[model samples]
Target: MDTVVQERLSTKIQKAVRKTMKYIVDEHDVRARRFLPRNDLESILNKKRLEQLFRELLSNEYASDTATAIPTGSDTGSAEGHDSSIEIDSAVDTCVKATIGTGNVSRRALLALFLYQPHTRLLSLYVEWLTSGHPRIRKPSYDDHEIPCDKSIPFTEGDLETLNIPFTNHGYIMDYQTIFTPMTIRKFTHHDFKTRDRLPFLGAKEKIKDGSSGTVYKTNIAPGHWEFKTSDGRFLPENPDTSMVVALKIFKTIEGPWGTRDAKEVETDFNIERELLDSLRKRNISHRMIMLHWGSFSVRDADGIPSYHALIFELATFSLEAFLKDEECYRIFTDKSPVLAGLVDIVEALHCLHEHLGFFHLDIKPENILVFVEPESVHSGSNHEEGRKLIWKLSDFGLAREKGSTRERTGHRLSSSYYSSQPSTLPATRPAGLYQAPEIQSSSSSQAGPGSDVWSMGCVILMVLASIIEGPEGVTDLSSKLEVFFLNAAGKQKLFYVRNDSHSW
Candidate 1:
């Protein structure tokens, strides 16, 4: 019996090691003429990212399993499943921490190994067992314990005080929740852009975009003088009143019993946005960005459960798509020079994003670009320079990622199709974009770098130019009519440039 147990343990360890290595290599250099001299594999694998990957794997594992899901409401469903999920989460967390503590392999190294081949059946089964929600053996004797509630959950005033998060019981979604802490709270300060008081303590007036994860609201912030409780418990007034409004983005929280199941994924998406915003801020590249987040706040639902999240951002007058649809602006965008000038501004912003910030706005359609029409144009109905003198900023960082990320990511993350005809409906199998780069469809590797952005930009410029020259109907028809011709011509031009000049496309 002892020998059998030992043999099983040894086999498991060997299998783990093999899976890790295979995932890391991922067979990227399968066509190498000879073995590469230098392979710095660790460059891609780092401790922080490795830990993140582990958390993701664990979250996915939990999400995929049906048994461990929490009950939907307070009155209905089984507490056993919720308890089981909690147990599994705790166990997995402990296991991962212990594994990382061992330091036999770096987190990045382990991640690379897993990514190379993914996990095999036997190893996956082993992991499933190791991270299972409950024991296979059911207890013959079980006792019922009272289900925990808001009052039952012991939280001290000192706890909130220690965190320095004010809880006015102001009926906000995030204030009442015991477990959650908004990611943006860590990034910004109280007085930063005067966002602390500017955020509304009340409910949203109207919802703008309702997505799978959350809703965007067209709400008003205080923009006026307000007082807040300081760490020393002093109520201090900051700034004078100004009537300024902002866009408030709110996320749905997992509520009832089953809510925790989906909340993790929602929180993950929210955190990604927060981290991206933090990166932008750290790089000091917020000037031309579409939306700048001031801070994050939590909102409480009717049940007084802190489930909803809100992020404050500068409100745009309108989207570029809206601008294009306006009959007043058609004359200005119709011309090449001013439209090209606007494109130059966009390019400058893109340069700041890609070159300086090392990020790519993966989803770069007209709707994602917001236009702040010049205040001077408020009264003027002029069709030339004044009409075109608008500022464009890129918004919606939901699908954005750092440059040179792996191409393993497969999804159509665009907001909505601008054209009436679907690109997916077209005969040729291509990426879901009229604005998508040519290489994104052709390249097997996942590196959609600055080049992809440039390609998308070219498409956007063409769309605006086409709309100017051909009209709105022409904008839709432009790609289908001329795509093949341009592609063929561009291919020839690429060869010509490569042959004649030192440059390569």
Candidate 2:
């Protein structure tokens, strides 16, 4: 008897739910077609009308009709029980789910109904019910409403990561209402670098090198003659009055080996370089290091996405590698003293890096060591002083690691001269005979540390000194000399002796 009554009640409830939804579709659903926001459509439907519709559908007359249509306690067989279940299923199918699945009602329109009346728990419950795959709720098609897109800023998922905000993934469009602002959206546009009001001049630039990560440009930051220091321990302005040439390293705004262009990577590079520079600023040892002005900034590309980071550095005359390759530059080698002096300054920078900053310059090579040209004293200085006067400083900390940090292999191609023998989890990629420490070569599990840097530095110094002593032959035979030192028994003894003697010196 109770089963019969419950079936009759369920049938009536399904009918009421269908009628209520149809009325809502007819009235509120009309405004949705005009592309009004979900809130406005709900306001048009109003709370009073929604409650009134439910009230009308559950009236006493409907209950009386439901009770009269099904006789209770009159049938008692398996066939009768099966027939009642079929009737209830049919009612739910034809009546309860008739509106949502088989109609032209947009998913946006239906979703909007739930999103309205924000403080209510109904929205969350409605979403749960809709997704539950209940027999009475049909799966609705969501293709009717086109997502509104901002054509001006066509940023991708990667580009949007630059904002550093949390967002929900909804296909191509993001749904982060609480986090996004008008200012944030404007940042996604490419209008920042065009102004001469704040940013430094990037025009009339000579392109230096365009690499996978960033582009480097040679630009004049100011106009004047410049020197790293004056004789009296005061720092000189970088030729602020006349042709202050500097190197501008601009990070790639788009297209870097797929994931390399992500904002996190860009931010990591920015923070690491900025913080490292910040920690090193104004120290007495900074004189021996690459001079990076606090002028670090960011810029958006044409697509309104932050594409690159801009940092201003004191321009190196050329790399030490370039200095060696020059035939004319080698004329100043009166002995090994010039190479030794430059090596001392580079070692000092490394000392500061290791002892003071707790950092290890993982990538150390002749190319990473920049040679700063000092202006001649206008009185035609002697070759001896000038030869030993070449200032060498460390640059390119892109692969640098703090001391005690685990070694992770980088994507950069290693020069044979610069490769360090550290056990890297990354495969031995592009291996050729070169200058890695014995520990690195013998075991793939050995980690890189300060000693690894010392080894690389020694190799660089050896090559430079060898080139000077052996004249043209050392530069040409650099590859063979490196191989002999790392591979030959006699060369190893000579290397050990040099290492011991260097500590005494």
Candidate 3:
């Protein structure tokens, strides 16, 4: 396990135990008309005992033979040939025996065991077990035992000024207010922007894009529900009623012929992206050409384990590739000048990244160039046009590195076999060979720098120009003509590049 993950899990467990114990003591006070001393409760419900009990329940519930773990209220069906109720009862019985012992257990201990349903994820099973008339303790009302959401922490004015984040009604800064603490993602649906496929089933995540490092999804955050206090202690969005849609990028474990990339490497990638974004935020560099990173949070699995670390970002209407391919959008860009201007905006953004920040966005391509179309313009016909307003921004910095970093370019490529196994409809996981600089294509090269990024940008420009002049089909034809293929040492037909026979562009 990654150290970060271990720390988060330990913290969550400790918090859960404390909350359960608190609930038990509160219930005891209500019943006996007298408060129990902290030491008395400690004798029955120490952190270690409750922590072990919760862990045992988690292990039993998530066992391979058991029903699905962490029943998120959606999966009510049981596993085939498995009686989950029986398993739950047995696990609960063993936990009660081991933690409380067979002797006369105190009412506080019974309440403590009963109140653990929410923490251990046993939910109704724990309630049902308690109802079997073991000494007839009165069942607590649902409202009495349910855990409340964490209260939003107000940001001191000094804190905001120190971080250089401004107080503004601008959508980007407003969205930033919702992310100071990691907000829990309750439900989200994924949409694949490239294929534009509607999900077959409802309530499923619409996967916008999948890459070698992570997957991105579109999700909504309720403004007031996730609102933050300002420097003066008032919530930024006084209204806080509306919902804002944002992009959720979740980092995943990468497996290839090289070997399986572990959680630590994935965590490192997550941290690098966060640090880069934070640097941009602290400098108050909210450029229109750069995607706004709201914040980052972790997603827990059924067993309450932090399965994936995710970042929140401003969601764009489309990618550059998707925009050019859509017939309606192509018609909107008929003037060609605006298309060229958008490309220039991207260039300026790259300049900010490379020159201002001293960072290299090694993985620059069409798919990473996000296009934000005004909502009003999306439905407008070509005849009604003041022309569609488009904002292009650079995104997906998983392969980015600082100017002089010594880290190897492990993310540059995947095994040929791994690449081949991906779905045909999905966009290329990384920059296609046609867009890669010669240095990136050469396995012998040690590193790619700013010039390499410029080379990639030039390739993007050619594709954009081709789309404006010849449309999507013309871009396809240009790609086929420029593409040169070769086999790697593994006898796999893997390499793709645009250089001529003499190795010169």
Candidate 4:
């Protein structure tokens, strides 16, 4: 038994090392996007390895299952096969002679192994079993306790405190949860700008020509895109066509031309937003919404009040509105194209933002849903009816929030009907032109939770569906038509209660 376990351990680690190496080598490809973080694989693995111990989880059956999921023609629904981790028989440890360090070599060394031998699966399993729902069997009499939080667990107030996270209840859930969040994110107390310059990395990275955010640029990251942000009056990144390129988002210090009251609030909000995105990505929550890639802050002029924050993120194409518009003019393949697949992508992203990520995407317009119509993205949109895998990425986290990250100063002037959360944020008025939410009279960015964003998304969906129905032979030019339809739709009383806020807004 000891020999078998040891062999299993060696095989698992060896496989893990090789698997990690593969991702490291081919780090830029999309399919190579594993759940593990590229920069700190060993640490994440060591923390999550325990969930594999009592089952075939560490075995190739698990990893290959997700990657090479063979679809059985039958509709049994268990296409993943009846063989799941839960079905594995418990390996009762009857005591082995001269065992070679199995099971975190006893939980005492778990934390040490997590930091030191980060690639060590043994420690990861120990931590997970103690916290996850797998339910660690404690006594031979079947007294099973789901590894609830205790003193030695991986999650606790101690961990949150260690992480420097504030505002929490307890337990070691992700930072978004009450488990508490550490503050590695930046707080731009000082508003200053550096020299203006074009980011060299943007030119070197692969360019993504997705109209809305402008051409998306990607770099060789640990299986992700490295984005940069800019504020050239365009919500999109400033590309090589302009001097500053690179990163996902950039903030111009000047608060438009008119409203500059809570400029500090605006700068702080943006900085916190960018920093929060980076922090979330670190937690490895890849449900659907955009996570952070990389970020930096710099100023161009000598005495610019608010500096330029350059950010870089994974590449994605045009917005939903843009896609619909383009489809309206130029035929984007058949109706059975990856377009339908985008529906699933959209809902999945919505669900994650609302339910899992514990935040709201206040700006959930069609433009927010980035599309990737590249050749590789679609196996064959023409003939491959079921092979429409246009991977949609949710980007622009300028308005995302954790469960309780809304207390900061936001620059939004609210109307009367705005929710409490929305009104509380300091008013950072929008442009005089842009259309406001129906209930919102003035240019107010009342921070709605995920539900509010859902209201916006619901509006987008109705407009798209309306276009498809009203158009001649289905709305072919989705990209071009989306914005016009939405702007028009916003004015109309399209906000159905079901589609609108269900939560206490």
* RMSD of each candidate relative to the true structure: 24.9, 24.0, 21.1, 21.2
For candidate 2, the lDDT comes to 0.46
Which whole-number lDDT from 0 to 100 does residue 130 have in model 2? Answer: 33
Give the top-scoring candidate (TM-score). 3
TM-score of 1: 0.45
Q: What is the TM-score of each candidate against the true structure?
A: 0.45, 0.46, 0.53, 0.42
Error of 1 at 144 (Å): 46
Candidate 3: tens digits of C-alpha lDDT, residues 408-477: 3345432121121221111122323556666553444333556767888998888888898889887777
What would the C-alpha RMSD of candidate 2 be, to one decimal place? Answer: 24.0
RMSD of 1: 24.9
Question: What ranges in model 2 sit over 4 Å off?
Answer: 1-204, 207-213, 222-241, 253-260, 282-287, 290-294, 301-304, 332-336, 376-388, 404-446, 480-505
Off by over 4 Å in 3: 1-202, 228-239, 256-259, 284-286, 300-305, 375-382, 406-432, 485-505
Which candidate has the top score in lDDT?
A: 3
lDDT per residue (tens digit) for residues 1-505 in model 2:
1123223333433332232223234443322111222223333334443333223332222243343344455565455546645544443333223212343332323323223213123332233233234343233322212211122122356644542223442222332221111111011112244211122232356776653345778864322213344569654444444445577777653564434456656655655655556656645555556544435666654565565676667678788877787766776645557567888888888887867765666667777788876764552456544533577888776656554443332333221212234423222222222344433432233344567677877878777776777755676676544322333333432221223222433
lDDT score of residue 254 within candidate 4 = 45
Error of 4 at 136 (Å): 75
**Pairs clashing in candidate 3?**
157-231, 189-205, 189-206, 190-205, 190-206, 190-207, 191-206
**Local distance difference test values of all predictions, in order:** 0.46, 0.46, 0.52, 0.41
Ranking by TM-score: 3, 2, 1, 4
